[model samples]
Target: MNTMTLWHITGWEFAALAFAALLVGFSKTAVSGANTVSLAIFAAVLPARASTGVLLPILIAGDLLAVATYRRHAHWPTLWRLFPAVAAGVVVGTVFLLWADDAVVRTSIGAILLLMAAVTVWRRRTADKEEEPESVTTRPGRLKARSYGVLGGFTTMVANAGGPVMSMYLLSAGFRKLGFLGTSAFFFLIVNVSKLPFSAGLGLIDGRSLLLDLALVAFVVPGALFGKWAVHRINQRLFEQLVIAATVVGGLQLLLP
Candidate 1:
């Protein structure tokens, strides 16, 4: 970090970051919110503030791969409904970042991840109780979308933690596997891309961070390919259980000293 070199970190740190990058791709293609692990890893490895910027481009790379793999199954109307609220949330997040210190950012992100994990678990448990799932077009559904969209945008801006929030929203809206993957692909791609200016303006996405990302991004390709190959064969229940467990551990790590 003092040297500002791409290889400034020790070998083990780089290995951890490389694995996290791979998870970013895998999460993009297979489990939607699973990258919460990657977010935690990146924040743990890099400075809390710099971690978000470093991870953004990597997430974008994964997003591109996801969109390419699941382009046809997206639900556009849902994405459209969430965008305006999400944009407002991003602005609010940006304003928050202007004053938040690294400790505050780290704590906020940790809390958000834990909260999102809880929400996901609750959604899953209650899923079978609903006789009819709400559509995004319903009056209640629009309110839900706005609420989740704002929260998603705020968290994504603050810590690249939007995935779980959006995942819950999509699940509550009743998306099946393919539609879920496709819609999320486009959603993150657009949202993350739009965040570039804000990150750069914040000095988070600097040349040094980009250099580190260059080394880490190569690992994402294979992870994404593996996800694409395994998506159909993977057991849905098992996959989500693992993701939630990992996310909980990550959140706890971030929260503790």
Candidate 2:
């Protein structure tokens, strides 16, 4: 089904989608991986494929708000290092999408989230004992960026689930709190908006999805505002942990039922 059909959903579904949209903004601004919750919700409420289409615009909108708030602090050099690999990954993901039906897309996202979350948690635990990996910055440079970039691109393109992957990389690279949010906000703004053509070509986005996006768009404002306030007040360690936990739960939900 196309975007036009989403209007037939019930009021309860609207409520659920609206809340998911709110989380989109909050996650984009304050807690990056919290978006796994919104992704899971969208996949559950709509088919995995169509949900991806409908959710992209909403994510882009949140990205814009985040960029408006954090754009000044973005680390552009890091982005340049990663974009080439990310573009390659997007091509691979588009190929995957061509062959995947709903079940394949669903399972792929669920598995990716679970694996990435585990990696993040393990890296965090071991970070104190070892020097941060050079895989994300300096030294190994090209090889490391390509590795993370491909994974990040593939995951983001498939399920918009790249946040956790990037979060782990950025943390290991020792980005300060503001730098992390700013880099992420802009990275996704460019990336998500870039996906529009591929998504449209795949027939994943259209009038129906756009309509759903517009209706739920306003809810993102309050969520984004709350995120901005909380980011300044919350402890960084606590926020990162919460994002990981939420991602794990969301991954489990998708894999289970």
Best candidate, lDDT: 1
Per-residue CA lDDT of model 2 for 1-257, tens digit only, reads: 55655776889988999999999999888988888888888887887788888899999999999999998878889998888988988898999988877677667767877887787677678765443322223332577678878988988888787887777667656666677898889899988888999999989888768878899899898899999998988776777777778778767876776
What candidate 2 gets wrong by more than 4 Å, as runs, is: 129-140
TM-score of 1: 0.89
Q: Which residue pairs show backbone clashes in model 1?
A: none
- Give the true-structure RMSD of model 2: 2.9
Per-prediction tally of clashes: 0, 3
Best by TM-score: 2
- TM-score per candidate: 0.89, 0.91
| lDDT digits (tens) for residues 1-257 of candidate 1 | 23264346789999999999999889899887778888888877777777888999999999999999999888888899999999999999999999988778768767877887788788788766433322222222778889989989998999898887787677666666777788899999999999999999988888888888888899999989988987888664665675567667666766876
Whole-model lDDT per candidate: 0.82, 0.81
